[model samples]
Structure formats: C-alpha cells, structure tokens
Target chain A: MNRIRKNPIFIIVSFFLLINVFFIITAGDSFFQLDNYFYVLKQTAMIIIVASAARFL
Target chain B: MTGNYDLSTGSVVSFAGCVYALMIKSGMALLPAGIVAVVVGILIGVINGTMVAKFNFPPFIATLCMMYISRGVALILANGATIRDNMPPEIGNLASRDFLGLPIFVVFIIIALLIFVFIEKKTLLGKYALAIGGNKNAAFFSGINTAAIIFAIYVIIGGLAGFAGVMSASRLSAGDPRGMVGFEFDVILAIILGGTSLSGGKGSVIGTFFGALVVACLGNGLDMLNILTFWQSILKGIIFVLAIVLNEKVMKNISKKTVAAARA
Candidate 1:
C-alpha cells in the first residue's frame, strides 16, 4: 500500500501496459489472431515512439 | 492470438484508402472532398488558438465549443447525410488509383505532415508558439505578442479540425456531419498519449503524429481481435486516464531527483 503511494502514477501506467500486453499475448487466435499483424505493430510502435519523445518537447 | 504483430509491412496509403472505402460506399466524392477536409481542419485549429489566446477564454472551453461548432457546420452542409452522392469524377479517381503502390490519400497525409513540420520547426512563429506555451508571462515580458500568438494557434487548431471534417466527407463520399462522432476525444487522447501536457508548457508535433498513430493502431488491433465497439470506447478512456496519471508521476520523480541532486 505504501509502495503504491510512492509511485501511484507509475503503478497505474504499468498496470494498463501490462493489461494491454496480456490481452495481446494470451488471446491467441481467439484473441490476437494472425490477420492484423502489421496493424498491431504500427500502433505499438507509434505509441512507444510518440510517448517516449515527449522528453524532448 | 498472441505476439502476432508484423512490423515490416505497414502502409499509410492503404490505411487511408481503407478509410476512403467507407466514405465512398456512402456516396461521397474523393479528391476535392479530401482537399476540402484538410482546409477545414486547419481552420478549426486556427479558431481554437484564437479564442484561447485573444479572447482570453478558457482553452478547454473554447476548444470544446469549437468542436461542436465545426461538427454542426459539417452536418448542416451535408444536409444531415452521412455521405454525398453524385460527386465529381475526379473524386472517384483519387479514391481508386494508387501511385507506385501507394494511395493518393497517403501522399496527401505526408504532404500535410511535411508542411506541419516545417511550420513548427523552421519558422519564427513556431519559436513564439513554443515560448508562449513554456511561459506566457515570460514571453509577454520579453516582447512577444502573446495575444496574437494565441489567436493564430487557435486558428490553426480550428483549421486542422476543418481539414479532418473534409477528410471525413471525402472518405464517405458525402459530407456527413456525424461521421466519426467523439473524434475530438480521440485526437486529444492521442496527443496526451504522445506526452503533451494539458498544463500548456510542453507539446510536440512529432509526438502528436505518433500519438495519432497509436490511436489508429489501437483501433485496428481491436477490430482484428474482434473486440466489441462499446469496449473500444472504454479502453480508450482508460488509456487517457492512465496517461495523465503517469505524466504526473514522471514529473514528480524528476523533481525529486533534481532536489536530491541539489542537496548533494
């Protein structure tokens, strides 16, 4: 609980990120499927690159 | 279902074309339609900037109002239709043809992006924009025309929104005011996800582009995964909240480290 308070934001972001990843990974064909591979990559790349670059701005 | 994303083969043109398909199916023109969309978007952006900076209206309120105005105008122009019928011949060609394996729509986006980058990086107005965002009081004290700058920014914002509207019309082959309802939220969400601060001191065009991409990607992923439409909204909202919360934490951490270093 104290740990959560020390870095609530971090925990929150990490939580969502983990959820996203879990859903992406565990859903398999029923969940992930193979048809939209490029779509997923394009999106993940865009988010990571854009979100990380806020440091420069 | 897991770990199946392919990075080597993504095409912006194809993406644009796919969107175009939806518009065309609804009976809208394609070329002039797209051009008009871009112009309107820029107008909306400009209006947003002007209202906030010049009139001294709250930025959030001003933008929110403008969003409704823009959409309402589109709906009125389209006469309550989601797509236009019997568009010009040029419109169909632009939507259908590919240049060197790329859709014309993709080229259009690239050009728009290039112009945006040039304006943001290589111009004095850009410098002033950043300065004002960083410290309005300091910028005004340093002889910058903060009011004029803000007005200009709002116009640009309004204009961009208009452009999006036009694009929506073109893709749908008809001017549908209701096309992509709640899209403003998506735009803001992308911006925040890209790391722009709501407090108005930090933002990046590059970040925005990436943020937009992220949103586009997420939507695509959901579709591929067969996620329900209602769940998409929920997911996006969750992301928005998480981004702000994360940003606050990151800022706090940085400040703490700075203070510790000063003490040392």
Candidate 2:
C-alpha cells in the first residue's frame, strides 16, 4: 500500500478515476456508453501521437 | 532534452498540413506530397536546432520566433484560406479507414508508441538524451556530443510534428492555416500530465498516452454534458494546475524516499 501510494502512476490513475466518476455523476448513463469511449479513443489518437514527440524532448 | 522547449510545433503542424493540402490539390501524388510536407517540417526543425544548438540562443526565444515565422509562412501559402477543393479522395480515406475494427490513426498511435518506448528503453540515444537533460556540462565532458544530440532531437520532433500535420489534414479533408491553433498548449499539457519533467531528464511514453486520453476524455465529457466552451476552458485550467501540483508533490516525496533509502 505504501509502495502504491508513492507511485506516480497511482496518482494519475486515481485522478483519472476521479474525473470519470465526476462525469458519471453529472452525465449519467450516457457517459458509460461504449460508443462514447470509442469516440474518445478516436479523437484522442492524434493528440497521443503528437504528445509522444515530447517524450523525445 | 537539454530542458529545451519547442514552442513552434503547433505552427509546424499547421504549416506542414497546408503544404500537403496545396500539393495534393495541385495534382501531386499523395506519397510525394506527404514526403514534401514532412521535409518542410524537417527543414523548420533544422532551423530551430541551428538557432539553439549552434547559435546558443535560448530555446524558448528561438522556438517562439520560429512559431510566428512558420505560422506566417503557412498563412501566406494558404492565402489565408482553407484549401479544400481538388483534394484527392484518398485523403479522406486515410482518416476513415480501419484495420481489424480499429481506426487507422489508432494503429498509427500504437506503432508510434511501441517504437518510441523501445527507443527510450533500449537505445544509446535515449541514454544520451537523459544524460544531456540531467546535466549538459557533465554530459559534454563525458563526450556525449551534446549539440549533435540536441539537434537530432529537435529534427526528429519536427518530423513527427509534420507527420501529425498530415494526419490533421486528412481528418479535416482540407488544410486550414488556422487549424491546430494553440495546439502546442494541449501537447504540453498532455506531456506535463504524463509526468515528464519540464526540467527534463525523465519521461515515460506510456504515461503521455494516458495523459492525452485524460485530456480527450475531459473534452468529450464536457461537450456531452453541454458545458459552454468558456466553462470548459476554465475547468481544464483548474485541472492543469492540479496536475502540476500533484506531480510536484509526488516527485518530492519520491526523491526524499530515495535519499532515505540511499542513506540506510
């Protein structure tokens, strides 16, 4: 548990979950749709690819 | 890698996309047009690299100047208009086509992620980048050819930005000079959210992937919730600040723990 607490990935994952929960509460079932998830994936693909360039930087 | 920031990536994306669209509209073959567009991006990178690595200009100032110059040139080339007519049908297909039920761009993302992860984990160049970023003078004394490495990093990033521009054009089915305006902010935000130190020396490609997903999710969720653009921007700002604070605190704790472990 302490090891997980110290991990940066843990923080990020927790933050991600927090945001999802917030959206779920506010937007309800629409936020849980599989199609919306895919839509998010497709929309973010380019940003993910470009953000990878910063990894080199 | 030397804690250098490239502010011109957004402009480079815009410039390269416009060039590709114009070439395709002018009847150039897709492959050739794409190559030229990427080359244009590389050329801009070379200029930026020279300014920073050769002339010793501050990275922020040099790239910021290049940003304006590239955007101006793109606007000129595009005649201040989006180029949509006479584009080849294949351009649209690039964005729409899927393989094995996955979007084509997602495949590209996966390929890019794998290649970059390999480079970061297994290559001498990766070591050199971290070394240079951690301490330039020490790396130089150790015979790292810091300038050359820096140049190469910038050039490679430029090429990637150019390719991204091509993808952007394909998605939009036109090259708008104004496309991707302020996009560098999103890229930087994603990188920071991924926990890549702005001060350099450490980063993770996988982390950046998730960071981008978070940003994308925020945008999509907000839009679905019928949030106004202004409110969405405000929310994103808050999240960005929170991410930075969280990252800093986490890093400090990790460093302190490492120090304690070392002493023990």
Candidate 3:
C-alpha cells in the first residue's frame, strides 16, 4: 500500500517539475512572473471554496 | 453499471434545471414547477435504464446519447437564452435559504449523504445495487431482479441529478444551458476519492465526502502553487490511476485475509 501510494506521489512531483521546466525553457521570463502566479490562484479560489465546502456536506 | 452514471448527471442537471426555470417563467407555481423538473429528470433516467437494461444497448452509449439529447432539449427550451426573469422568489429560496446560519444547499448535501448512507447500509435496495454491480450475470442466476435494480439505480441517480439542477438554478437565479460543462468529472473524482471502485460493486458514502475534500484541496493547492490548468488535468488523471491501484491492492489484501480466516 505504501509503495503504491509513493509511486504516484513521485510521479506527480516529477510531472510538476517537468511542466515547470518546459514553461521556463519556452517562456523563461513570463513563466516565473508573480502576476501569473496570482492569476492562477485567483482562478483556483472558487474551485477551492466550492470543493472544500464538501467537508460541511 | 454506475461507472458511466456521471454522464447522465451532467446533462440531467442542465436539463432539469432548465425545465425548472422555464416552468416558473411560464407562470407556474413553485411547487408544481419543481415537481415538473424532477419528473423530467426521472423520466430521462427511466429511458436510460430501459435502453441499457431491456434494449441491451451499452450503458455508456445509451447514456451518452441521453446526455446530448437532454442538453439539446435544455438549450432549445430556453430558446438559447438564459432565463433570469419571471421566476418566483420562493423557488430561488429553496437553494439560497439559510438554516441555522448555514446555506440550505449545503444542508441538502448533508441530508442527501445521510439518506444515502442509510440506504447503503440498512436497505435492500443498497444490497441489490451492489450485488448487481458486482456481477450482473451471477446476480441474475441467483434470482435477483437485476433489471429492476438497475432501473431503480438509474432513476434514483437521475432524481438526485434533477435536485442538483434545481438547486444550481435557484442559486444562480437562472438556468444557463452552458452551465456545469465539466462538473461531472469533479463528481466522479470525488466518488473515486471516496474509495468507490471505478469497476463498481464497492462504495462508501462517507469516503465520497472525504474524496471531495481531497479533490478540492488538490485543486486549490495546485492553483496556489502556480501549476497550470493543463498540467492539473494530467496530474489529476495520474492521481486517480494511482489511487485506484492502491485501493485495489488494499481490497485484495483484505479479501485474502478474510479467506484465510475462514479456513482457520
């Protein structure tokens, strides 16, 4: 069970790194911009609030 | 049987909610309007069940067809315009009303969870849904009413979807045909996170609640960490595959232990 869980976590981290690398290599300056970071967070806020409300559900 | 049930929900929400808004728009009373929308949802489910159970169409195809049909009907019913006017305030109140400082919709979900938990644990309907899902052919041989059970399952799911539709429309104060485009995926992810097997036959209502939390957290975390939506989808798929693998292994171990204990 631990191995099964671990393998996926590793894959997720690796995928995350791979995407970040790709974006940096292609658009280095824009990829690391603070505004972009905030923009993504802004879009994710609603999903978070709606999804987290399931705890109450 | 339920592996594709999510497909029906996507359109059912849109379709039923559309009917609800339209009914009120046409000057129908709140009670009757809500009833009409719910009936439409159940009828769609019955049609889906008939297609899969009696006519021998594959569940995926039949429900996929229903999804498109229902969505089309919704879009047409509103004449491609969003319905925001002429709705009775009482109808909207069902979704937005507060109970003890909590949103009514959240309360509804809790109640739904409680009722589902009871049905899953204490009712024959729950047992049969599992039995049929586990093995339809064997369930048939054992004298179970597989067809009827399957029909009931779809109809129940449809009714729930209808309720969701109405709540959504009420909250927004209008029904938009284009709403909830990919919500089915989020719901499926929640169910799977809840430890329900994608292959069917095993599920826990409580687990689903937790699974929903997990998805929400992951989505939130990803966004906070600056991950792109494109990458988020891929990562989500990976997590689902990994979770299923983990769940299968755990189930196998538990079953093996039970078998050994029986022999002892």
Candidate 4:
C-alpha cells in the first residue's frame, strides 16, 4: 500500500481504473467492451505521439 | 530541457497542415509536400530557438508571438476555409490503412513511443536534456553547449508537431486552419498527468503513454454516455485541476521520503 502510494504510475493507473469503474456502473457492461477500448486507444494515439515532445522539456 | 515552453505547437500544427494541403491541391506529390510542410515547421522552430537561446527572450513571450504568427498564416493560407477539394486517394490511405489489425496511426504511435523512450533513456541527448533542465547554468558552465541542445530540442519538437499536422490532415482528408484548436493544451495535459514536472527535469515517455490513455478513456466514456460537449469540457477542466493537485501531493511525499532516508 505505502509502496504503491509512492509510485506515480500506480496512482495514475488507479485513477484510470476508478474512472473505468464509474463508467461501468453508470453505463453497464457495454462500457467494458473491447471495441470501446480499441476506439479509445485509436483516438488517443495522436495525442500520445505529440506529447512525446514533452520528453525533452 | 531549457525549461522553455513552446506555446506555438498547436499553431504550428495548423500551419503545417495548411501548407501540406495547399501543396497537394496545387498538384505537388505527397512526399515532397509533406517534406515542405515539415521544413516549414522546422523553420519556425529555428526562429523560436534563436529568440529564446541567442537573444535570451523569455520562452513564453517568444513562443506566444510565434503562435499568433503561425495561426494567422494558417488562416490566410486556407482563406478561412477547409481545403478538401481534389484531394488524392492516397491522402486517405494514411489514416485508413491498417497493419496487423491496427490502424496505421496506432502503428505510428507505437513507433513514436519506442523512439522517444529510447531517446529519453538511452542517449546522450537525453542526459543533456536532463542536465540542462535540471540546471541550465551548471550545464552551460560544464561546457555542454546548452544553446545547441536547446535549439535541437526545439527543432525536433517542431518536426514532431509538423508530422502530427500531416497526420491530422490525412485523417480529415482536408486541411482546415481552424482544426486542432487548443490541441497543445491536450498535449500538455497528457505530459502533466504522466508526472512530468512543468518546471522540467523529471519525466518518462511510458508515463505519458498511460496519461494519454487515461484521457482517451475519459473522453470515450463521456461520449458513450451522450454527454454534451460543453459538459465534457467542464469535466476535463475539473480533471486537469485534480490531476495537478494529486501530482503535487505525490511529489511532495516522495521528496519527504527521500529527505528522511538521507538523514537516516
């Protein structure tokens, strides 16, 4: 627990999961589908690529 | 690494996209037009680097001026309209084509991720960036050629933004100066969420990957729920603030632990 708390990646992953859970509860099982996951990944790929510039900053 | 901000990134994307589209519309081949667009972006980067590094202008002010200039030029190029007429079939191929059951852009994302991760973790340039960002004066005094490094970083960033612009135009099958408005904010948000300090020095490409994923998931979920665009914007703003607060707290905790360990 303390170890996990210290990891920034863990915190962000937990936050991601929390948001997923919220959507699952509100939108039902449809929110957990693989197709939706793929769509999201596709949409955000450009952002991840562009944000790579921050690696230097 | 110079701890300099490039506020012109979004505008550069627009400008590059417009340039590419205009070239294509004028019967230029795909590869040549793409090259020109990227070169144009690099030119802007050179100007910015010169201003910030050689002239010692504040990064914010210099980039802000470039932002306005680039966006104005983009608007003028497009004549305040999207350029979609007579686009070649190949323009759609970039966005539509898939490899190994993945979109080409997703493949691009993977390649970019690997390349940047390598640069950040395994290269001398990475070390120099960290050194400069962590302490510019110390880096300069250590004979690191700080100006050159800063200039290189800006140029590379410009190239990336230009590529992103071409990708955007390809995806839309048109170039619109008005497109991608405020995109730089999204890029910055992903970096911040990935735990990159705005003050520079510490960050990781892998973390940025997850950060981008988190943002994508949030936007997708919101759209799935049929939320209004205005509401989505509000939620994104709230999340941005929350992420900042959480990141700050986490950084403080880590620092405190490190201090205690050192004392012990």
Candidate 5:
C-alpha cells in the first residue's frame, strides 16, 4: 500500500476516485451523466493543456 | 517567479486577442492580422524585458505596470465592447474546429509540449534557465548572461501568452478585453503544483504539465458537483496553500544543498 501510494499513478487515481465519490454523493444521478464529465473537460482544455509551457528560469 | 511577470502574461493574451480581432474586423487578411497581433505581443515582451533588465526596475513593479497598460489597451481598442461572432472563418477556427479527427488545440498542446520537453532536456537556453532559476547570483558568477536569460524568459512567456490569447478568443468567437482576467493565478498554481520552487533554483516543464492537468481536473470535478463559485475559490485557495506548503517542505533540503554548494 505504501509503495502504491508512492507511485503517481496510484495517487492520481485515488484522487479522482475521491472526487468521483464526492460528486456522486452531492449531485446524485446527475453526476453519472457522461456529458457532464465531457463538458468540464472541454471547458478547461486549454487552461490545463497549455500551462505546461512555463520556462521559469 | 518573484516577478509579477505572469501578471502581464494575462494582459498580453487579452491584448493580442483584441489586436487580432480589431485588425481582422478592419478588413485585414487573416494571416496579416494574426502576425500583427503576435508581433504586438512580442513588442510588449521587449518592453518588459528592457525595463526590468536595463532600468533595474523591480520585475514585479515593471510587469505590474505592463499588466495594467496591456489590459487597458485591450479595453480601449475594443472600446469596452466585445468583438463577437463576426470573425472571418479562419480567425477562430484554430480553436473552434478539430482537424484530422482530433481537437486542433489538443494536437497543438501535444506538439508544443513535445517541443518544450526537447528544449528543456537538450538545449543550452533550457539549462541556463534552470541554472538561473536555482541561483541567479551563482549562475552569474558561472558566466551565464543572467539579464539576457531573464529577458528571454519573459519574451518566451509573452509569446505563449499571446498564442493563448488568440486561442481563447477564437474558442469564444469573441475578443473580450475583460476575458482571461486572473489567468495568471491559474498558471502560478499550476507551476507550484508541478514542484517548481518559488525560491528559485529549480524548474520542471513536465511537472508543470501534469500539475496543470490535475488542477483542471479538480476544478472540473467541482463544477460537476455544482459547487458554488464562492466555495470553489475557498477550495482552490486551500489546495494552492497546500501545494505551497508541500513544495517548501520538500524543496528545503534540496535548496540547502544547492546553497551550500554555491557558497563553497
């Protein structure tokens, strides 16, 4: 378990799981709608994708 | 970055979009309008670089001034009105339409990042940026042209911001001077989350990339739950603070080692 936690993949998956759980509880059935997920992804596509360009020397 | 350099980046994006839209509206060819707008952004970068590097103005102060200037210019150019929906088919098409069965912007992001990764790992400029970030004084003592490097950094950031400005405007099919406000905050947060040190002496393009994705995911997930904007801000604030705390703690030893080496 500790080893898995050290892996970024595990951490990211768990984080998403936690978020998924929280949303499922709060928004209920609406949370399961695939389109909602797609909408959120589309909304921040640029914000998320382009930020990696920082050359912070 | 001690400099409010990122602040001006947001403005550059707005200004570039406005310039592009205005030129296109005035019947310029799409290619010329795009070129002119991006050149305008680069010119702002030159101003920022000169002020900070030559005049010895504090970077934050110089960039803060530039920020307001650019934003104001964008607003004035548009006369406080949004330029919406009348763009030539090519104007916003890069962001709005997909090509080859993939979103164009996504493909752009992939290619741009691949290029960045190559540069960061293989180029002299990238190494200089990392060295300078780690310790400006040390980098200078080691014969790196610190001012030139810093100037180049701002210019690169400026250019990226300019492209982003075009992308956002195109996606919305409008150039709103007020659009992209507070975008710097997101950039900074993304950087921090990627393990880039605020104290200087370290940089990670890959980390920044993943960090940005994580932040976007968090924000999107919250929106899914219909989280109020007020609560979202608070949550985001918490995450930002957490990332900072984690970064400071984890990098403390590394910074200490580098500082010791520099002193030696």
Candidate 6:
C-alpha cells in the first residue's frame, strides 16, 4: 500500500477519489446525478489540460 | 471531485456565462458564439503572458491593463448598450443546442482540454514552457530562448482569447462593448485555485482542473439552493481566497515530504 502511495499514478487517483467522496458527502443529492458527474468531469478536464500547458515550464 | 472541485470552473463559467447572458440580451448566433469566446480567451492569455515575461511587467499590472482593454473594446463595439435585443440567431443556437446528450459548451471545454494537454505532453514547446516557469534564469543559461517561449505562450493565449471572443459574440448574438466584464477575474481565480502560484512557477494542470470544477459546483449549488446574487459573489470570493491558501500549503507539504524521503 505504501509502495502504491509512492507512485504518482496512485497518488493522483487517490486524490481524485478522496475529492469525489467529499463531493458525495457534502453536495447533498446534487452530486449523485449523471449530469452532475459529467459536468464535474468536463470542468476538471479543462483546468488540468490548460494548466498543464503552463506547467510544461 | 464534486465537493472539492477544481477552481477553473470559475473561468469556464464566466467565459460561458458571459456569452450566454449577452446572447440572451442581444440574440447572437452559434458559430460566432464559440468563435468569439475562444478568440477573446486566447487574446487575453497572450497579452498577459507576453507583457510579463518579455517586458518584465508584473502579471497583475499586465492583466489589469487587459481587463480594461477587453471591456473597453466591447463597450466601443456596443455603443454603450449593456443589454439589448436582436442578437444573431447563430449564437442563439449555442444556448439551445446539445450534442450527444451534452451541452455544446461541454464539448468545447473537452476540446480545449485535449488540445492543451497535447501541447503540454507531446511538444518541445511544452518542455520549454515548464522550464520557463520552473526556473527562468536556469532555462536561459541552458540555452533556451526565454523570449521566444514567452512569445509563443502569449500567442497561444491570444488565439484562445480570440476564439473565446467569437463565442461571446455568438452567445449574445450581438457584440456589446461591455461584454465579458471582470472575466479575467474568474480566469485568475480558477488558475489560482488550481494551484498556479501568482508568483510564477509551480502549478499543475491537474490541480487546475479540480480548481475549475470546484468553482462550477459552487455556482451550480448556489443556484440550486436559490442563494441570492450578492451572496453568491461573496461566497465565490471566500472560496477563491481559501483555495489559494490551501493550494500553497498543500504544495509546501508535498515538497517537504519529498525532501524528507530523499534524505532518509
């Protein structure tokens, strides 16, 4: 488990999973909708992609 | 990532929302809607990056100038109208249309994401951009043409802003001189929220993705909860501040941990 935690892939995945759990718990019922999931994914995708471009520096 | 959504959602919202609001006000068409939004976004990005990296102008000052420039241009085009009717039909379709069970804006966001990721991962330019951010002096010393990299960054930003502008025009179906007021505010907020330091260097595309998501969720939640407009603004402001602080702390911790591990 510690070895997996050391991997960037695992770290990133775990971070995202924890974030999802937070949303599920705090966003009430809105977090459960299919549309909401898609919306969040789209939003997440945009920031990561764009910010990554800047990150190349 | 719902509860702890990326702050970039703020930018996406402002970009899309401004267009939608303006389109409803004037009735712009669809193609123009997408085009304008993209153009405007790229333009601002370019101007901000260029002035700071090349002229040594501070990012805050450079962007502050652009904020006014964008708004001023919009106001000039609109002839002083804030809201009006007779927007183009092409832009109107943007608000009304969806593709494959999703909003058109959603698709645009996806395309924007993929293109940027490709730029970051698959190009020499990408490495240069990161190099500049990570250590400008070192990059210059190592034979990287710092000015060129900055120029390319600005050009990309300008093109994106121009595209955003077209979208804005279409979304409103009319071009108002006053369109996209305080848009840079949202973009900055989103970028900051995604862990992009204002001081330059040390930011993550992945973090930014979450940042934008967080902003969008906040707005969506507020609207759903029927929160007042004023309260919404206040809430967003608070979130932006908190996100910046938290991002910095998290980055610090990550670095500290990495160092400790290395020593051990």
Give model 2's TM-score versus the native structure: 0.94
Docking class of 5: acceptable
The 10-residue segment of model 5 chain B with minimum total lDDT is B1-10
TM-score of each: 0.67, 0.94, 0.76, 0.93, 0.85, 0.72
Q: What are the runs in model 5 whose C-alpha is more than 4 Å off?
A: A1-50, B1-5, B85-90, B256-264
| Model 1 agreement with the true structure over B1-264: per-residue lDDT tens digits | 000111101111122223343444555555544554445445545555556656676655765575566555544544556443554444445344456755545544555567666766798677776676667789889999877766655444444443444333344444444545554455556556555555555555656665665566567657757899899889888988987786666556655766799999
Off-target runs (Cα >4 Å) in candidate 4 are none
lDDT of each: 0.50, 0.83, 0.66, 0.82, 0.72, 0.56
Write down the DockQ of candidate 5. 0.33
Kept native contacts, fraction for each prediction: 0.02, 0.65, 0.00, 0.65, 0.31, 0.22
Docking class of 4: medium
Q: Which of 1 and 3 is ahead in DockQ?
A: 1
Tens digits of per-residue lDDT, candidate 2, B1-264, equal: 357878998999999999989988888888898899899989999999999899999989999999999999999998999988777787766788889987888789889899888878899788888898778899999999888888888898888888888888888989989888767878878887887767777667887887888888889889989999899889888988987887777767776887899999
Quality of candidate 6 docking, DockQ: 0.26
Q: Report the lDDT tens digits of candidate 5 across residue range B1-264.
A: 322245687788888988888887778886777777778877888888888877877877898899999999999999998887566666666676676766676667677778778878899777887787766788889999888877877777777777777777777767889988777778888777776777765656666766666666677667766778789889888989998887777678556766799999
**DockQ comparison, 4 vs 6, better candidate:** 4
Candidate 5 residue pairs in backbone clash: B133-B201, B134-B201
Model 3 regions lying over 4 Å from their true place:
A1-57, B1-6, B85-91, B220-232, B259-264
Q: What tens-digit string does per-residue lDDT give for candidate 4 at B1-264?
A: 346778888899888988988888888888898898889888988898888878888988998999999999999998888988887767665678789997788788889998998998899888899888778889889989888888888888888788888888887888889887777778878877887766667677887888888888888888889998899889889988987887777767776887899999
When sorted by TM-score, best at the front, the candidate numbers are: 2, 4, 5, 3, 6, 1
Q: What is the fnat of candidate 5?
A: 0.31
**lDDT leader:** 2
User: In angstroms, how far off is B156's CA in candidate 2?
Assistant: 1.1
Models sorted by DockQ, best on top: 2, 4, 5, 6, 1, 3
